[model samples]
Target: MAADALPYPLRLQGSGIVLREWQPDDLEDLVTMLDEPAIARWTPMPSPFDIEAGLAYLKRAQTGRLSGRRIQLAITVDGGEPLGEMLLFGVTGDRREAELGYLVGARHRRRGLATAALTLLSGYACGTLGLGRLLLRIDPCNTASTSVARRCGYRLTGEPPIAQAGPYGPTSLDTWEYVEGLPGPRRQRLRNVAARRYGRRP
Candidate 1:
């Protein structure tokens, strides 16, 4: 699929939520969500996540979208109440891969929104973008994220703890990596359906 043939986002609405692009106004809600310790502990965020930092990150996310390297979505109910955020980063064209990362607000945990949205996005990536594989990385300690990956049919390939830059300071983080592909019989059936409906071949 050509880049122009795909909708950069293509809003997804279901389960009383709409997953769409990041907006300047969303900074306030995101700031509040990031301020929660539940979200901060497992993910990488500044020690004291504040409004200013949130705004800056929002701007960077927009930049990432414009450059065609990333998609950062705001998870919200259909009526505009914010829930959380999810991101897909295109790692390499040669590799034909993208990485899935997400965080749900404390109040929205245990709902199927995360898994559902992820499933939809994974389909879009494969069907619309013609990607062969999607990579999901989860912090070793984040059982919720790991569970989401497993439930969505990603197979764990490795467990490696590596150092990466963080908001506060450099820290070692362990992550479990998983991959999704369209080669399997079940995935091929779904891909065929998407091709017929979306007018594109994956």
Candidate 2:
């Protein structure tokens, strides 16, 4: 399982956000998150995403979890209402790399929800899952997502944009990469009793 995908039906707690698998009760809220003009513009999520589309999406998400093909989570706070979605897909065979994507409801934007959720999930993917790299494909025009990716430590390289096939067919996107671990040495030093820890860049 470690080499194939994330732990099935995962749940994680962060400082202010929670990452969890989809549930039956989240159907309506799922619709709320995906069925928006912004979502349609930025994502390959089904257009006119209604209850029917939500049902299909729920089935797909659950099945993906069961098959260990990919993982998607509901982004929430205090385990309350579902406000957005975060997903890791296109996993490499060794599970050392994968693509990450997220969406927040229109009403829930501009509150640092995306940053909180992405930061939490990125930590899990690197630390718990031992992933060496996570990829984020973004359209340059979508400044909101670009900002979120940058804030969460995803960096754009000289690598040219690639065309990826999605539910909406092929689209060109900028590739942003997130490598595991912190970039610099530890700031605080322990005295003779202990050793200070530093992170290694992948």
Candidate 3:
């Protein structure tokens, strides 16, 4: 799909959280959050994240949106104070599927913010964007992320884990795939497509 055809700078709101496009003003919070050791270890972000890296990331996010490749949003409360970030990328236009990624700041952990962000993003992808599947690639060792996936109703596809290259090195990661529009023919279709794409049993 063309970049103009897709919704760039999308904004979604939930109970207490809002997911919207990244802003230049979010740089400080982005650097602070991504600088956490746990965030670097679990996510693909650069180690020793700094202002420069944060600026680069913002630039890439803007470019990705214009290219129709991804949408990266800042997770905030009441549309103020960025507490985290989330993204939907690696979109497959033919399959109507995309990957989901997110991280909450160290101080903001365990407050259901990530879950709320995921919920809003998934709803937008499946409902507004009319996408069929959303895939979350998570490290099996990251129990927190797995918990979020479960809470958001994502299922284990039973597919073999794959390796993701990060700042430290390559680490094996599992795929937690979410298929929306469940409980009917659409659900079965999504399940079948997910199974086939991820090498899971149908």
Candidate 4:
């Protein structure tokens, strides 16, 4: 339940993909995923995301991991080129809750990478990290991400969207929750999927 609950150079693999910590060489891929109209419209990522912004992001990711505030990982295949990113952030002081976020490049949509990446991270968070709850905030209009969250057993709390300042501009976000030990068919199914794919979680 400490900030160090997340190890450095973290690598979690499952559902035919690998999610690992960011590296210096991943700047291009990182920028590619963030520097898009849809990414900007749907999420809080910066517009005109470029190499320089990616460098700053990498530094923040390292600091987040070391300080136990958050963890940002690159979603890749076979540990090769980065396809996108996944994050576990907003870890509460009690270490009982956190948030999940992800993004895939424009070319990589519809390939199920987002779903696979979420499933892997969701399992790692609830199983190994032992967090009591994991949640995500997003605009309801982003059906792609909303679908991924539901498929991974997150349910909308039915509360109103919260308005806040994003890194780029004003944003409104809907909250969804995925609590540990929640009894339901979808939860069980995800567990089965994780077991079948992630024989070892680390």
Candidate 5:
């Protein structure tokens, strides 16, 4: 789809949460949340996140939207302070496929924000964007994330052949697939494509 056709500053609302584009004022919160050891360990973020890195990320978030390749949104409550972030990246227009990634702040964990954000984004992707499928890669040991995926209707498709690279190094990862329709050859194709892209067994 064209860049203008897609929602750049997409805004999604849930029970008590809203997913909207990032703002300049969010830098401090973003850096603080991403600087946590847990966040660094789980995500591909800079080990020692600083203002510079945060600024760069903010820039990329804007550019990514304009490029029509990604949509990065901040998860907040009532359009207030940011609680976390959600992204729909690596979008393939013809195939109607994209990858979903999210991280909730340490202070916001265990409050169902992650699941709520996922559900909102899933609806926007399948309903607004007309995406056929969405993919998620999580470390197998991350029980919280695994649970969130399951709760969001993402089916376990097994581990990938290769591992996902983190700040420290690479580690084994699990692949999950979520789609609105029944699983078929198209779902399998998405699995294979994701596996290959992530250096996993295809």
Candidate 6:
């Protein structure tokens, strides 16, 4: 999608986190966090993170937003810190399914930021976007994220025995799948409030 096609603005919170679009200024922070050994260990990030890679990622995320392929947010606490990212991707033709992906900077782990962001974002997907299901592919060894998924109401479906490479990977990693979102009035209300708070049309 073209940059012109994206109309939604950044969404902010009183807690100092702003669910916002990618900016040129965020490249430095992205490089810093993505280069962390622990962050790179579980995630499919480039091993030797650099300015060029960060810029490229920003561009792709923006384009994905424009095309509706994904709705991505830069997770920042104390506002504008780019500590991590959360994404709703794999939107299909019917708009019935999408997958969730999240990565918090090693520094930001264990702070409930992931849970808060996931809850907020999941509501947005179901309420404003009207998606029926959200899937999560989690690394089995990452117990923290696994617990976060459960806390956010995702139910485990099963686990894959070995690693699975994504389209961009040379190797595969073992994964556990979980899903959330079915239709209901409670979900509608959550979406309504989120839409109003985030300046999205109800």
Off by over 4 Å in 1: 1-9, 14-16, 165-202
The lDDT per prediction is 0.68, 0.77, 0.81, 0.79, 0.80, 0.68
lDDT of 3 at 126: 87
- For residue 98, what is the lDDT in candidate 6? 79
Model 6, total clashes = 7
Candidates 1 and 5, the one with greater lDDT:
5
Question: lDDT of model 6 at residue 138?
Answer: 66
* Best-performing candidate as measured by lDDT: 3
Tens digits of lDDT, candidate 5, 1-202: 5743457667888867999889889999989988887887778898799999999989988888776678799999888888999998877757478889989999999999999999899888888788887888888677788778767877656554446688877766677889457467856665565445444431
Clashing residue pairs in candidate 6 are: 162-174, 163-172, 163-173, 163-174, 164-172, 164-173, 165-172
lDDT of 2 by residue, 4-122 (tens): 55688688897788888899899998887788766877777778899999999999999888888887889898777988988999988877788999988988889999999989988
Candidate numbers, best TM-score first, in rank order: 3, 5, 4, 2, 1, 6
Give lDDT tens digits, candidate 6, residues 1-202. 4432323554645334666777778889888888776656666777677888888888988778767567788887756688788887887777777788888888888888888788777777777777777777766566687678767876543334456543245443333233344446655554454344333432
Best candidate according to TM-score: 3
Question: TM-scores of the models, in the given order?
Answer: 0.77, 0.83, 0.86, 0.84, 0.85, 0.75
Model 5: number of backbone collisions: 3
TM-score quality measure for candidate 6: 0.75
lDDT of 5 at 94: 76
Error of 4 at 35 (Å): 1.1
**Per-residue lDDT of model 1, residues 1-202, tens digit only:** 3464335645776556678988788878888888876666666777578988898888898777777677778887673867888787856766476787778888888887788778777777776677766777555466687678667766544345576655544444443233455456655554444345334432
Q: List the residue pairs that clash in candidate 2.
A: none
Deviation (Å) of 59 in candidate 5 = 0.8
- In the order shown, the candidates' Cα RMSDs to the true structure are 8.3, 8.0, 4.5, 7.0, 5.4, 8.9
